[model samples]
Target: MSLKSTVIFLLSLITVMAKAQIDTAKIKSYADQVMVRVNIDTNIERYVFTEGPEDKPLETILSINNKTRASFSVDYKIISGTVSFTPNFLPGNNDNELKGSSSYADFRFRFFPKKIIQTVYYKKVKGFYIENMQDFFPEWKEGKDAYLQFPDLKIQSFGGSTAYVMKKDFSLKSIYTQGEWQKESRGSWVPVIDYDLSIFTDIIDGRKNRDTQYSIGASMGYFYNWVLGKKNRVNIAPNVGLGLGGMFSSTRDILDDGTKSSKENTQYLTIRFATGLHIGYNTDRLLFGGKFNVTSSAYNEKGNQNVQNNNLYGLIYIGYRFPPPGVVKRNYDKIQKKIPIL
Candidate 1:
């Protein structure tokens, strides 16, 4: 062949070789993929994950609410497998799942961190809880010295009850919870103290030596409640309790306007101090003859014993009581004749 013909023939052969290489790679790329699985830590909050001994990191395909989905063609690359997420959700199907849902139908796509997957954990930020207020008072009228395994979820509650608690007026003052519910054995709303350890910067200036001084505090709380008195009829409801680590870091930050930015970057800690009385009652549940405690608070700080100064916490509950089911009116004339105080 002439010089030009020889060059053209070589180029044609090179093109054919490149095409064969592409075709071969495509045929072998997906033959050894593996199936994906999931591990759950419902208690932990910030969703995290990891890879197992015989596994690789999953590429997140979706993440919303308490669900997540990750995709990986690597299954086809290794064990030739496919990924399908099955969610334990309510009211929906594969074809018509909810938008932005972590349900079975729509959780197959999530944003995954590009790295080796570790065991997934949740990030705990905030929750509602209750306080077991009976310990401090041994003479409580009802259910004194009782502790039901701390409440995990509180449906509704009232801070104090006349039938189940000691005196209508308790010296224990108030019961506070860090989370949402308190302890009532048979009632569904057992109180649980949830942690809402938040991160923020604050600037506060308070002179503690005097009662007139002011201090700013940020508190997190949980919610729970129980059935009171008449067998699931009346609710001693919506017990809300919270604990802020004694480390009440407060600050004053303002940007041009009077708005302040309370953002802090420090090692976070939630220290429990001074078992104070917690009294907060919502109007909806406390409508006995009238409403009860609009709000109640207590806080204690570490100080010198010589100072002899401490914040005094008090009790204030406003509610009405109904007569028991068997209560009957007496005949005034006959009763007065038998025992007359006049």
Candidate 2:
């Protein structure tokens, strides 16, 4: 409001704006530039596991950082450090590669040891001019020679596990499900997983179907799957999920037929549970599983709890498996660091 106050406010705003506008190029113009290098490729692939239901496509569920993932495994060597990589990226993964060459490894990757080296160097091959690096790509000034060092990171590699719910879902075909599992005994999949839950909604459902159903309460029960014998690639699996939940059928308005139907369109709570069976269909790390349980939570006319006393409930699901997309290619080089330049 006053002249002095206005000037001070304007100057502060200008200062903040200038700071916000700082760029990589400006940071490269430093009086003293130093670079560090390591003997490994800095850029690598990242993956995570995922889940799916019958309707939506199975996706590698992303973590908090927001990135799709497939699998995780660790790599460790005698003197070499450890790094994490996705199993889908390469066959046998880092551990398999090491196993073939080494007589014995002190630690298995499953142990997930911590031994990342710091301030390592790489072979100096060829590089851009220092003037250009200083003026343009400030991030590329780590090498003393042609081969510039990549930025050092505290995390050497990534290796962990995850859980996924099914997204691309399926419908209930038959009441009973049975088959042989790849790892399980050679016989029928447990048939009639009692208390099986099954969701009986349309295929085109979203928001977990928001704006569509009212306060719904659901729960799930028994499940079953259909596994195949060795002929089906030794582990070809067809999945069936079973569970139950409750969704309010808020569609009791006057129908186009105009029978003045108040069909059970009352507002009810949604509560559902489900059981699912995922089948293994590919050599690649993929899963295609499904559910068929029942959800049994409902609401009264006033959106209050109203679960049916009956055990047969509608089934809903959440999962991390998917059908093997025909053929999958693995980057063998990325898997084995003695990688070939493609």
Candidate 3:
């Protein structure tokens, strides 16, 4: 054969071998291949395997899988040498099998985070005094120590909080707050020693010394989440927390000379319990939400050492969440019960 003809024959032979290899790969029996089966709403989506071990890093695997399908769920099972994701989810149309009343439908696509989430939020707090005025100053009552009515005190405060989510359901937070008391309609009364006799004295001409306060507190809590919408774009989470700390304040007092004394800095112990409701919309990269919380505190009262200060706070906040780092991601399915240092 001539040189050009020999070269053409060699090329044809190589093409035929490559075609045979492709055909061999395509005709592999299902029984010979491992399978990843997902059953959703009675519709089953099966993924046939090729090689390597069946075990894979779930986070990296999920990170890649989530890019294509927008809505899905995750449940895995390894039975008799078969690795299956039973009750898994897919994008297109799937048969609806299970019917019940639950948030499961809302969370049909369980896209839980495996990374640490850091959140910064600003809150406006309106404080309400719950103790009776007579309980604050009993000596101000004339003759019988009968009830001495005083105008309710209103406190306006603003604060910022930083929180770190250590796990999918648990988190820790720290808060810093500053506030002042709104002027009351009537001035507060103080018992003063005048000419060796105790007499009632007005602290201010109209409104008494406006007490100012600042506080730093630490809290920890757990949240339960519900993912809403067919695409799982809306999320609602409710959480409950308990906190303990103290408040420092500059308060007005009475001197032995029966005159208004200089403001004295005092520290009071505070015990707080709070609950929050969060509602929001989230995409893969961004989240925006509104949070409403109520916190009740019991503090050591300074005015009447015998009575305690009962304080209630109502707070409202709005904030956004950014994408988290991928390196911190973990497979929650494998380590859901493990606890981490907070």
Worst 10 residues of 3 by lDDT: 173-182
Error of 2 at 262 (Å): 37
- Say which candidate scores most in lDDT: 3
**Runs in model 2 lying further than 4 Å from the true structure:** 1-67, 70-225, 229-233, 236-269, 273-277, 281-342
**Candidate scoring better on TM-score of 1 and 3:** 3
- lDDT score, residue 105, model 3? 15
Sort all candidates by lDDT, best to worst: 3, 1, 2
Q: What's the true lDDT of residue 264 in model 1?
A: 41
Per-residue alpha-carbon lDDT of candidate 1 for residues 1-342, written as tens digits (9 for 90 to 100): 763564355345434433332211100111111222222212111111222232543211112232222222112111112233434442222222222222222111111111111111122211211122244344644333332221121111112111122121111111221111122212111122222222322222321110112222333322222223433223232232333432233333455555545544222233221212133332222321111222222332233111111112233333322221222223433454685531
Cα lDDT tens digits for candidate 3, 245-294: 66777767455555766777777676655554555554433334454554
Question: 70-112 in candidate 2: lDDT tens per residue?
Answer: 3222212111222222223433223322111111111112111
Error of 2 at 109 (Å): 18
When superposed on Cα atoms, how far off is each prediction in RMSD?
Answer: 32.8, 30.3, 31.5
Higher-ranked by lDDT: 2 or 3: 3
Which residue ranges in model 1 land beyond 4 Å of their true spot?
Answer: 1-212, 228-233, 237-242, 245-342
